[model samples]
Target: MGFGDRWRQWMMSCISIPKLSVLINGSPTAQFGMERGLRQGDLLSPFLFNIVTEGLSSLFQKASNLGILRGANCGNGVLISNLQFADDTMLFLEPRVEYLRNARRILRCFELAAGLKLNFLKSRVVKVGMKWSKSNVWADALLCKEGSLPIPYLGLQLGARSNMKTFWNPIRNSIKKRLAPWKSKFLNKGGRLILIKAVLASIPAYYLSVYKIPAGVANDLEKLQSADGKFSVGSFRIQLEDSISDFSVDHKLVWQDCCPPKVEIFNWQVLRGHVMVRQVLHRFGVVQWWEVSSCLTDSIKTWFQGWHGLCPSISHRRVWDTLFAAVIWSIWESRNQLIFNGEDPSLTQAANIVKFRTALWFKHHGRGSKIPISTMLLNLIESCRESPPKKKIQKEEELIPPFSLGLKFNIDSSARCSPGDVGIGGILRNLLGKILGMFSEHIGVYDSNTAEMTAIHRAVTMCAETPGLIGKDIDIVSNSKVTVSWVNANGVGSLKHSKIIYDIRSCLISLGNSRVIFNSRASNSFADCLAKKGSAMEGDFLSREFQ
Candidate 1:
């Protein structure tokens, strides 16, 4: 589930007359408008075979060139699912959603002009933090920042999750990923034949039987494999160790599905405390222009701007605006604390009166207006009030899927209390209390939402890549109601929190079109407990094996 997502790329060079049909479009006579040429004894369509071979040959050449050729810079964006075939590429990036309509239309125009049309339903835009993943690799796992994620490429959701259904999904999807390496290693027509057989044999019977996987239905494949194995899918069980020879139909047909042992999971968390004093700063105003107006030395004034993520290398106007905003907000907050607490205030009492006068002079002479100061004050308080209070929130709502199943998919964010890092935990179990594989990870934090968002990104990726985490319906436990609601809904959140909504949507799509629920924190104790295992959330982790 990294940048390349381990896609199945077949550079099919030579194809057999009959086999090519099943490999790509399945019986071209019926599928490709070619029914007129088929007869009971007609030789396989040599014409189709020739056309396919040439295409595969050309595709392999591109792929081979790609090995030595550094791929194009999709820019500060992610490249995901292929548009139609293996050769087509999907790319993404971020920006605001308000402009998305225009962007999509523009993209559509270029797509048509570029000889490829985008499958709109398959393309997307996730509203994320302005700088989310700006300087990093696809953290298959993410530590998303607060606000929305811009999944600016295909509509395929491209974010994170904190649920097990998404986290362990790859294990379920392993059969497909397993064949990826084999296919890429040999793209020739003869090699593709062997690849097809290996792929056919590699599918998980449980995956097929229950039809939870995108592959074949389990019951039918079971009949083809064994007479006794033909049980109802509802009653079928997956035994990965079962050999193909057990089908009772071959001279020593020893075959194993191409599943690799799962990689052991490792956990990491961020440090405690914020790099900036947001709370104290909040006690002031959001924008502090007054500081620039106050009497301060040029050196100290310059130092402040650098601390708040402003580039020192910008133009004079840019630098002043940066420092101006910081100072105004800080001074405004100072005035508020004093006014609210009934403390005395006097700019005249400062020892640095000379600098204070310089600061005041800069502002008075400048064409700036803090006239909306009262209005701004009202907005800041509302913003702070809307954030779920840190005193610990535990509210129970009606249980829903991806957590509605009797088996619990516990989810909780650790970074809420602990600074810098956060963690998410998920587990699936049967009524018998046997623990199916449980997954948990610590995500570094950029904001309160970042950790929660990272958890979400992981969840979606996990469920999409793995199988058996969910079947029909399941329960998903979480401490964050906002996140659960956002994921379950078919659309984005309201204007204020749309970005978070968008990012969550991108990740949830991989759940293969299922509805997940938001349960209270207490109900999600298993995940909550693990997530709050605190900053000590180090080392390889798995739940204590349950009976």
Candidate 2:
């Protein structure tokens, strides 16, 4: 509202110069002056609309303050009068004739003052906690249609339980609508991955941001994105979780590299042991057992550590990580060439290809653009040494036990594959670090985020139910920043696991002095181990307490 004169002048200049045209029968009409209102798709339209709507919002506030209007009362004496998003508006008021009349008068006054007409015919008066006849009377007072609960607003159903699968139908339908066009087209694996990542994955983002998607709904969406109707065991979700489980300490290396996405994805597959190499092929019975080489195959973790050991300087580690990805990609490419094209694999050629690819990637994507590829390829180690060393002061963190009278609950989850087996684990302990109780259970099929949230929910519910832990200050710890942040923020930023978040909030409220906090994965090893066990177990929940 305190915009400078220059800002106002610029806005006016932009708004005043609207030489708009229309098309009729594929022919452009002559340009004409826009008499009033902003263009439909203009960037400034939302801002200007918000500014205009603020007047109506203020009017409602003033009316509520004057006791001429009554709004819905939230807990702790908080009252909500109206909510406006772009042109759509929701006014929450008591279902009374006087309030409706006052609202109608306010809308009429706003129409006259702002030169915007109220669309009463299109508007609906939704009544809550009022009889049908009485609600009809109130609607008649405002001269609008009467509406019921669970009405669609801003693409989400209002007044409906978020945990229900039906509440997520809109998101599922939206994704299907977008997928419908792409399904008819024949696409390669890479093309399908790109389409899923860029298009289908984004369809429910808005809904996900607002409401926690149900597990069933998330699974359905994942299935739509998968190349086959069934979930892929080699999906990024499973690979990422698998990498974390296998490496435990160095899993971050896979994503910390600057390689192209396709290469990075390939590297992730390699790390997850999902890549169909000779060993995997033999294990799957695709290759004859006798054809398997006598040479022992090193674990992916062992190979990853070997690469880490090669870089002495921490400054050159990132370049080394990129080189690692390049080398792996190059070797895989050579193997493919030998298998598919009958080309003999050559070690020197693979090394050259790795250097060239690494140098090219660094030249384009990394900070070594000015450095020549020839120089890098000739002496890769020297090229890495040329980059200035960056000193980082990292603060080390560890697990902190709760107050002597309080209890700490560490939670973790393991999701094997997309819509695959999901396991949730939590360990409860006293301030003395003595184990109080612990739980591990396979909780059906769900994504990793949902599994993490379920772990938190299970922990909180268990704490609330424990008679010995009642009225004590509780600390809920998880390695998942998303789960911790969502729980702490009361699920304001995202609704990806809204049902579990809701349960968590309810449990916390009941506990009175409980909080959810995040810690490093290293500190949550017990829960992680328990979760992995649960994932491997068959439909069994393991809970135990130590004296």
Candidate 3:
């Protein structure tokens, strides 16, 4: 059935607002039935042709180790565990690069082990929800036919959760488990400041060290250490010390830039308090928030309350202890933003937002003892404050690829649109910015998703044709991982549009590169911006940019 661009565009305008995300022809779309439409073709490949013999053996062994495959299942038979429709396919071999030597060994192993030829095209590893949860979004490494990053079944996107609530449980539970001892110790008689400081200073320093302030954020810690006195906040006279220091903090004292207030401090030690306070806030935050998502949410309200036959409203008394505290912190920050930066966010409005988001978070994920998925989301935004500056691509650099023989490669699509027209473009570059040529297509009436797919198709065509394009160190970059996964995840020849699939797979087989990558639109803005050019065939594709 043909798709409806007008209706989809109208719906897209309503739900996916422009401020929070990219406004395209529509929400990013994927090639859903790409693999389902495959027809009778030459399945002239070997079973383990994609991986090396040792890699193949190791792949089987890893499955056995994971308890995913054992006993009779381990025999030399081709082990295809999860294959639903022609679309979703997961193999049960040793999906590790450590097991194999170069890409060549991998190809021979497939023929030797499964007696099938390596269908280099249409074969790539996929991870769901790493960047985009849509069917096609994917990491580029998995797209590499040979040198491409192998999507080892045992390994996928790190820290990926199955559902919002369950995902945070382990982290949530671990935090609770660890803090329980400390909370108990603090409540101990004579626990006093020494013990309190010891627990606060050490536990966070050790446990959350992974969440350390990035080097860029702390780059001048030493210089600031000496100048701590210069940046003092109040009578407290705070500053960073080579060794940890302590000063009583009133949560009311410091200011934070986050709309929901953060404590302001003269010195960095405020962060120590912030961490513990935020921990407490987050703990109660999750507890209270989960109640709604797990219960009061509109769709799941009935089911949530119905869980375990308990009165949903009757949650533990302690859950609400810090509920207002978290809200207060948020309001405090928003008020400060309006006052100091003239941001103009009302205190009442800010509190409502915090409440709404907290409730929605729980509706999607419960605030159980486990770390909630929203926590990760929050942290991702917060961490950007400390992350190193992102590298911007230089202009006109990809015209000629760097020195490397035909190495393996992959391509990803990128697109961005405006009110009138949509711009679609694709770039084929390597780790080093060797331009292996790129393509741009424009559809006057298009949504963001369709434009994105067009870019991917164009990129695939370019990669498949030109000689020496086959096995060069290649990487495909796109802002949308969803597009990459949906189109590249399936077997090429299997798709009804077998030619597109075949061309992509053919590029992988021919190239000798590492992998394909899907980046955020901000990072891949260059090609995407290029793709949206002027009206002429070669006019600046970004029609909106000119205006």
In model 1, which regions exceed 4 Å deviation?
1-407, 416-419, 494-513, 538-547
Name the runs in model 3 displaced over 4 angstroms: 1-420, 434-438, 443-447, 491-499, 512-515, 534-547
lDDT of each: 0.42, 0.78, 0.42
Model 3 alpha-carbon miss at residue 253, Å: 21
Per-residue lDDT of candidate 3, residues 20-86 (tens digit): 3344687754422222112224232232233223445564555455755432345467444322232
Q: What is candidate 1's lDDT per residue for 56-112, written digit by digit as tens?
A: 334433433454112233546533211223344332223323223333444455556
Error of 3 at 469 (Å): 2.2
lDDT of 2 by residue, 1-547 (tens): 4568998888887777889889999999999876667788888876887878888999999999999998999868999989987678888987678988998999999999888898889877775433478878877897889897779876778877788888887777887777776665643345466756577777778877877877887887787676544446556666678676554435568776578989988888887778887778988989866644445345775778787888878768878898899988887878788889999867787778888888888778756877888888888866855455566643321245763358888889986655568788888888777788888998877877888888888888887887766678888888889777888883364655676777889899898788898888877888888999898777667985533
What C-alpha root-mean-square deviation, in Å, does candidate 1 show against the real structure? 32.0
Q: What TM-score number comes out for model 1? A: 0.25
What RMSD, rounded to one decimal, does every model reach? 32.0, 18.8, 29.9
Which candidate number has the best TM-score?
2
Model 3 global lDDT (CA atoms, 0 to 1): 0.42
